[model samples]
Target: MHELIVSPFLGNHLVVRPGSPKGLKVPKHRYLELQQAAEADGAIPGWLHKPVLRQWGLDLRGQNARPALLVRDTVSHEYGRASYEVNMACNWECPHCYLGLKEDTGMEWSDRELLLYLLRDAGVLWLQLTGGEPTIDRQFPAVYSLAYELGMMIEVLTNGSRLHNPLLLSLLTERRPYRLTLSLYGATEESYDRLTQRRGAWKAFRRGVDAALEAGLPVELSVIVTRDNEHEIDAMYDLARSLDVRTREYNNMTPTYFGSGETLSAQALTRGGQRGVFTGCDAGHTSLHVDPLGMASICKVARDKQLPLLTEGLDGLSKLGGIADQALLRQGGCSGCQLSEQCSTCMPLAQRYRQANAPLGSYCQHTPKEVTTA
Candidate 1:
């Protein structure tokens, strides 16, 4: 459990805490000084004494002040954030899951370590650990600890199934992820169990949520609105209130990553709303994503192409910006569309909708001038 993490973030020298977003920038020389100090049991640098004490409440001047610090190596190239799918195995069978086939396998220990180190070297500071259910992965703790040690602030996206497990709970409590996002299927047992197709799922979820909040973990609830559970949406919000945690709602469903429309069947027809204007995104330019097998993509949705991280290593990321650029272009089905300028869906996402043969109303604007004659 290090008190401070000193690393290079997006070409800037930064000092960040383990479970917090607040960061302070320091000069390169000072960053190098702290890196050297971390290697030896030397005095805290005079320039850092006040800011460190004021921010973290650690008195570097105290005789007993032996602040545990971790200094990460600088990277020549990098992104600011990334999401890694730790595993595809889940304890529940929610039909709305966009993963399609869920496999219970991941990289070997050595390759897993390499992936984290690569992420570190690529300058990924905010790392998200997601999965079919990341908590259930046998190697989750090791993967999470390695990412933390590599000076990345971690966020975990889980189905809330294994959060109550003693070993897993203890590990999370001690390490303290910046946030633990749990997906809420329904407010009560009947709808929840039916929706997830897992008996006693509501009970397990309640236990996990309670234990996490009681343990002072930063927990957020994601209310997944679907046809089966939309009736209980109000109750779901009430449940989040009762638990005194922040909550977000997901009203629309996307097709499977493989372009299958099966998962979209769960969307609540009434709640299927328009996405905000797709001005643009910083996907590969400022952020990236990686799957369980070390396949790096621009993001989760536009994953038709990927970079094999295990094979190409960090240097391979140089091509990611080009991939991202191509994904945003109005090509294929969207090419020559009249309303493309103001369209909310990007080209890659529109491609998924078209692949599924989804109704135009599901994603495209319904105006008369929406599309041009071919």
Candidate 2:
């Protein structure tokens, strides 16, 4: 007779049943709910001796599946940082936007909430919420509040168009993000609107930025460096300084997942044209990216491919490691190059272009030509 077991791993939660074709990666609370329900019905979370798994030729790292004796990690108590694309659907299609404008094929709201609970259970200390625009999601409030209640530090990247939203602003003021990074397209409204291609976006953005500051939410600004707005770098700093907020200057924009430069317009410069070598990036180890539909990937650059964490359970997770390994491997000239620290190659950017045989899109003026010449 086959038995049912619930185990949580560092990467995923597994509910596996012997002889079953598939299992689910359940959320933490739901898993706990199942635990309580089992206890009520008088059954311990199923556990077999470690030898049983080896005997069956099964190789699995169950984070916290405690048998009468604990072996491997059965349940994970370690948490770090994660950035979820709350939803990929967007109102604005920025020319240089990485993910490109696409329908929300990501997970539904219900499942996302489950992921959040599971994330909390996994001990995630900081959570970054981003999207086509996270505030556009109807279920944003529920998700945001749940993460906040979990005591996770929240970082939000947004266009600031919706900060003035009454319900959302109210939620922001109450729960409050640890930091809100606002995208500043240009210093002037006309220039900003031209870049975003929205007629009244500057107004909405201004309103949102003002609203966030007025509500006492910590705010920072990112000046996107593109042809249309590259000249406004100093002005952007002035703007940030005037608002008494910190600023980040962005020069690189990941190409569309297809690795085509279709989205790259004059306003969006290519920041990866140099012959730089990939050193390393913080995709798999330090940070993970989850898209709208519960598809998890190592980073934003790898968004097109994702592991279905909930459906395939442990098998999906195991495969995900392989994917990250393949992605993290130093490809091309980077393998022999010693200028990794100086090379302009961003791992994600290199990975994005290498598979497609596509040329790196644009060159950073600051790239040291001699260093990458190798």
Candidate 3:
């Protein structure tokens, strides 16, 4: 396993340790020097040796201490983050899942490889692997390996159904992800199984969580709340505390990506917490999202700007910024709304709410009191 990676982040270069968030910024000259040292099998540069030990607790003093340093040679664009949905297939079906239809489909191995390289050329240093459940995808391991080898920090957003698989666990153990974000439906078996609409989902989820923690993998839990398991909300928090792992709560519900209101019925009245007022985001400017078939979009919620990455290659990203600008404009239902200044929901998300024919108070600032309730 490689000890550290050197890649371009936005405009600057950074030396980042796998499975860790902490990173050290390096100048262009030092970045080149480190690349040369790694390639020529030369001595560890004096400047890098101490920081490696101090930041990650890895020593470079011993004669056999040859830390595998992976360096990215070029970055043609400035995109620093991206999310790829490996496949739409999942083992369990939750009522509130934003992905309306879970289809077992994805790009072939050859196309998958091409997409990873395109991401590298586009300067994506932080890559997220998401899906209906990324672990259940057949090509997940290979995709993960290729991303890691390309020096991109990886975060796997999974449902935790297949984490207990020995072969999958072994691969993750050898090449750790920056973080494994597991979604927790409920604290108890009845609630868990009922909510996911699967028979043995609770048992499988528990086994996966236990195995992941036991292996000392970096794990974080996303406590998801819905009408089905809202009764166990307090118990869910207690369970996370007992497990002694990092956790966050997700209570906000949105219409499915396909513009369906079917998922809105599962929304819980209890507010999990504040997500802060949404000012704006660098969706297409610094980050982009890719679906299962290599189609690029501005962001998950805003699908108006679709780019054919497989056909256009990295050149497609150049148009994303402009697409982002047009999609974010206050138009349609939001045209000339006085409350647009203090609105928490962005235009793209508001558009989804409108398409679903949701309640007037659900996403519109026109109903201020209801907007704050969730």
Candidate 4:
């Protein structure tokens, strides 16, 4: 079971990031008072009944079942929710793919088990598994099984191509994931093939989703917005809703497709321009992305500048400062830009401004004149 901590944060209600527990503030002495109350009658304050709070392990019955704090002299470290990019091996090669293609060098199962053990030890109650196509991994089932057994609510991110595989479907049926987030590239068969550049992929995606839903597994769809299928977004939305579950729209393929030196399709460029400010990135501080080789970074975009988690373990936390530690852009395109109040420029897209080959302006075509200078 996951455990939560009550600690002080930015002068308001508690803050709960992905991998960390919810931190609720109380008068210092009131902390013990609540714990005692929990012990006496499991009386969790009504304020603790936020849905997200309950998801992070707060007992609504007012019972505080968090593990007793260890009497350690060392200053504590925060390790909350985790995301593991099990492999870069995907079955599809959509033109907009940033990493180019998947690599075959897989992580060892022993190390995989070890990573799970470490995460569970750190009180990780949620684990997200994504990949080029995580199901393509031969050992995916084993790794996912271990995570499930560890009591972590598991989320599998897939391109929806191979969910129809018998073995993978069997495993999913057996373990039953918290949710299967299907990355939908298009609304129609032709559009899916055009966007994903895979023959019969749309058929496979449908079969997979149907299999999961038929097996009584919860499924959600997130349409991957790209020039190839941008026009079909509404159709995709209608399709998603027809499935009778949650649905969402993802990336316009602009800032997200940075670093690969690829420009957006003229379509994606025009339908969307940069916003006045954009700061939704929640990498290093809240989320951790670990590649198959054990390189852990704040997010997939910043993987090149990552730390090897196998060697550093918890001690590596100090070295994992994300966007804040990054140097100023060459022209300082993102520096002192209050447009960040309205600017969509984040570290990954900001880093591209320094790349001679990068279509920096294309990513942020809407930057106002005054805020353009660092």
Query: Best candidate per TM-score, number?
Result: 3
Question: What digit string (tens of lDDT, one per residue) describes model 1 on residues 1-374?
Answer: 67788888777889887766577899999999988887776776777878988787766674321357778887777688999999999999999998988999799999999999888888888999999898888899999988987778899999887888999889888887888999999989999999999999999999999889888888999999999999998999999999998998898888888788998889996686668878999998879999999999999988988999999987889889999999899887678776777788877878888889988877786565557745
- Which regions of candidate 3 fall more than 4 Å away from where they truly are? 62-67, 272-275, 365-374
| Per-model TM-score on C-alpha atoms | 0.93, 0.71, 0.95, 0.74
lDDT of 4 by residue, 80-189 (tens): 56788888877777876665545776678888888887666544556889877888888899999888666566788998777777888888777667678999888899
lDDT of each: 0.86, 0.66, 0.86, 0.64
Clashes of each: 1, 12, 0, 14
Q: Scored by Cα lDDT, where does model 3 land? A: 0.86
What does candidate 3 score on TM? 0.95
- Residue 198 of candidate 1: its Cα lDDT? 93
Q: Give the candidates in order of TM-score, highest first.
A: 3, 1, 4, 2
Pick out the ten consecutive residues of candidate 1 with the lowest summed lDDT. 58-67
User: Please, what are the lDDT tens digits per residue for candidate 3 over residues 280-307?
Assistant: 8999999999999999998988886699
Model 1 clash pairs?
Answer: 78-122
Query: What stretches of model 4 exceed 4 Å from their correct place?
Result: 1-76, 254-258, 266-270, 274-276, 280-282, 322-324, 327-331, 336-340, 353-356, 365-368, 372-374
Report the CA-based lDDT of candidate 4 relative to the real structure: 0.64
User: CA lDDT of 187 in candidate 4?
Assistant: 87
Superior candidate under lDDT, 1 versus 2: 1
